[model samples]
Target: MKSNIIRSVLSATALGVLSSSAMAHGDEEHAKPRTFDASKVEATAFGQEGNPKKVSRVIHVGMSDHMRFSPATISVKRGETVKLVVRNDGQILHEMVLGTKEALKEHAELMKKFPEMEHADSNMAHVKPGKAGEIIWQFTKAGEFEFACLQPGHFEAGMVGKVLVK
Candidate 1:
């Protein structure tokens, strides 16, 4: 009887895990864009609004499997429209999201809760292993900001960088 009970518990646990995985990945909401509120986001941060055609310059950055970003520090001029040419040289997924420290932490928390979540924004770039992406952003404000990869354990692994706008 004890063996039967143990089997039942294991089966139930497996089912629960499978169901939650399906729920997280199969939900249409997971793929929906999590739009940011322009007014409440941050003052010195670049808003997710830009035209790539008008990009003033392009900055190249690389991501490694060690959970670090190369050229982790970047700077731009105020009112500059720049394109971030990001590449994932890692063996796993990676992303680059721009925001203030507080905002980034909040967004990273949300990403942890809904790991399958995805969004299309100018201030963000997502790249798969051995892939590259770009984010064209207009630095409207002059201040320090952060860029991070909020994919589950990536952010916790210190996949973050600084952006200085002057």
Candidate 2:
């Protein structure tokens, strides 16, 4: 009986979050997921690819409320194609945009200006509340990068993470 009550609460909470995020990205253009130009994203940055054999590892990331990402930092090998499976466990819209620290900072600023930015890039996976998304990309070079939610105030709220490709 106790477990049932808890499950009901959880379901309601998840529904509330999805509803809010849907409203935020209500326009069909923003709600529908689309792929963008990975070539222009940056050479050092991870780019999306379909090389399944190249995928050396699968990483599961969780985005939740309080502007947090579980396992804040991830590591990968150079020349490795990693599968990033990100899930939004919170009751809001969230995303994982991968890039260098500087690039992320710049992009975050741009997000503030264009809160409704739509994207479809291999290096980015935006998930709605209670939904899961994936990004399969190869780390072409060894370096540091970041992933964060570009949803309006999410980045500012500290929803960011680091990726170290060595």
Model 1 agreement with the true structure over 4-84: per-residue lDDT tens digits: 654465456445654563443222322233343445343334554555567899899999889888999999998888888
TM-score of each: 0.73, 0.73
lDDT of 2 by residue, 25-143 (tens): 32233334434444544454454453555677899999998899997999988788888899989987788888777667766765565464444556677787888888777888788
lDDT of 2 at 131: 85
What is the C-alpha local distance difference test score of candidate 2? 0.72
In order, candidate lDDTs are 0.73, 0.72
